[model samples]
Target: MLLRDRVALITGGTSGIGLSTAELFLREGARVAIVGRSEDKGKRALERLEVLGEVTFHRGDVSKEEDSERIVKEVVSRYGRIDILVNAAGVFTGAPLIEMSVEDWDRTIAVNLRGTFLMTKFSLPHMGEAIVNVSSTAGVSPYPNGTAYCSAKAAVIAFSKALALELAGRGIRVNVVAPGLTDTPMLRGIAGSEERMREFASLVPLGRIATPEEVAEAILFLASPKARYVTGQVLVVDGGMTAGRVTTAGSRAAVR
Candidate 1:
């Protein structure tokens, strides 16, 4: 067990990559606190996870400072201290710059960037081991309609790197897991249908989208002692999507 008897707080833990990480941590012997904004989802997650190990759900919107502070206090009250903090809560928005509304932009930044900041700020005092932030391949690669999401995710990567340096002396490690095109409720919402999601998968060199469990494995590695020397880095789990464009043998580009 990589995290035997440790405590972990995972935001966005009710679903997708966050939920998967919670399960993995529990199996690794960590008492887990899963945070989210949806009460219904939280309840369901607790019901599903309670059998696995010691697990609790803290429902709060991480984008708000007060909520983030309260959630951290609640976790600390139950667990005494935090060994891992995973900021995985996020929202996605896409539009051309001129057509994008202020509300959409603000909401995207609030949940993705500001939420990470608030959670890390409050968790730091109680946290002793690691912080793994969930970013996206979109952080480095640009797309036509992802201005707000791309900007917020890029900021998360930069913030993690800077904080890693600041907290190195304190024995705290901060790192990032930037996943590409994972199959999750959030991505499903964006894709609108399974067929559409498959279409999106074709864009990746791997010919398939990642499972949430795969991304969670990356998070688990960063949070565990296995990565004790690893800090201030971005681990991209994109299945060669960002490596380079894939060209078929029949294509003119492949001829060169």
Candidate 2:
């Protein structure tokens, strides 16, 4: 009952990490409002989460100011106020900079970066406790064909740090959770096949990709009272992928 009677709003809650976090929050005694762009997905999420606790789904694109404002209003209208806000809505467009079109870049930033800004702006008045913005290890570590996504996620970390300082006096703690490769529908779409996913996992030190629940656990900690003194920080849940290059020779040597 870490969040007993608290109210939480989670964007991109239709699937993946956001949906997992919503379930965790509800089980922890929080009234949850899940937001997503797909009405059908939102309905499905509602059906799945309603049995756990007081859960509702709000369908709207976070990239739009009107939608962000309206969604926040609806959540507040029902829950009275927001104790936690989790900005987890994002998009990944993998293409080299020269090959990437202006439209694709704009859409990526709109959903991943602008969406976070709009949601936080509108939800601030109702939020008094915590804000956990989902970032990625890609934000700190660079890779090919991730120009827009990496930039947006990196900005999220910077944004959260600055906002944390600004909101400290108001008792609002802002933090970021940067997860590495995760096992989600989005990752499945990206990986395309099981063999490719296994290949990706082989590159990680832990030999496996993360699960949504694992990342959700981190989010729950940051959002809960357990992290009252934790703010302006980035928690990396990457299975040690970012720790250092794990070479076979190095692994053998270390074992000796």
Candidate 3:
């Protein structure tokens, strides 16, 4: 119950990691506001989340200033204030750099990087406790075909660091959670096949991909009171993937 009675605002909460985080926070006694772009999706997610506890949904695209401002205002209007903000809304693109269009590049940066920026900007004045920006291990470990995504995520980590420094004295802490491969719709869309998904999982030292709940746990930890003194830190929840592959007896571990 680290978030007991706190208010958390999570972008991209329609599904996957964002929705999972919202669920965890509510179970921990937080009044959660889930923000996303689609009204239909938001309502569906809200219906699912309501069965658990106090939750609300705000429909808006995170990458837009007006939407970000509107979403934050709506959340505040419902809960009176924001105690935690989780920037979990993001996009993934895997086209070869040579063929990647400028629009895709800009879109990637807009949703993953600019979205976090705008959401944080509007929520800061109301945020009294913490801000956890959801980065990716891709930010630190470059993957082929992930130019735009990697760049955006990397920038998010850097942004969180600078934000943490700026807000250090204000009692509002900021941190980043860089999750590795996880079982999510976005990943499913990218991998496309079970074999491809398993291939990705095999690269991890832990021999498996993370579950959305697992990454969400790491995010909640950073946002909770236990991390009061922890800020400007990038917590990599990759199940040791970023730590490198493990080998035994001079043999490579079997890929899942």
lDDT, candidates in the order shown: 0.94, 0.94, 0.92
Off by over 4 Å in 2: none
Cα miss at 119, model 3 (Å)?
0.5
Please give, for residues 33-136, the per-residue lDDT of candidate 2 as tens digits. Answer: 99999989999999999999999889999999999999999999999999999999999889999999999999988998899999999999888799999999
Better of 1 and 2 by TM-score: 2
lDDT for model 1 comes to 0.94
Residues 1-256, model 1: lDDT tens digits: 9999999999999999999999999999999999998899999999889999999999899999999999999999999999899999999999999999999999999999999999999999998999999999989887888999999999999999999999999999999999999999989999998799989998887779999999999999999999999999999999889987676763466557
| Candidate 3 Cα errors over 4 Å, as ranges | 245-256
- Each candidate's TM vs. the true structure? 0.96, 0.98, 0.95
Ranking by lDDT: 2, 1, 3
Tell me the tens digit of each residue's lDDT in model 3 across 66-159. 9999999999998999999999999999889999999999999999999999999999888899999999998999889999999999999999
What TM-score quantifies how close candidate 3 is to the native fold? 0.95
Task: Give the winner by TM-score: 1 or 3.
Answer: 1
Candidate 1 lowest-lDDT run of ten: 246-255
**Which regions of candidate 1 deviate over 4 angstroms?**
249-256
**Clash totals in order:** 0, 0, 0
Most TM-score-accurate candidate: 2
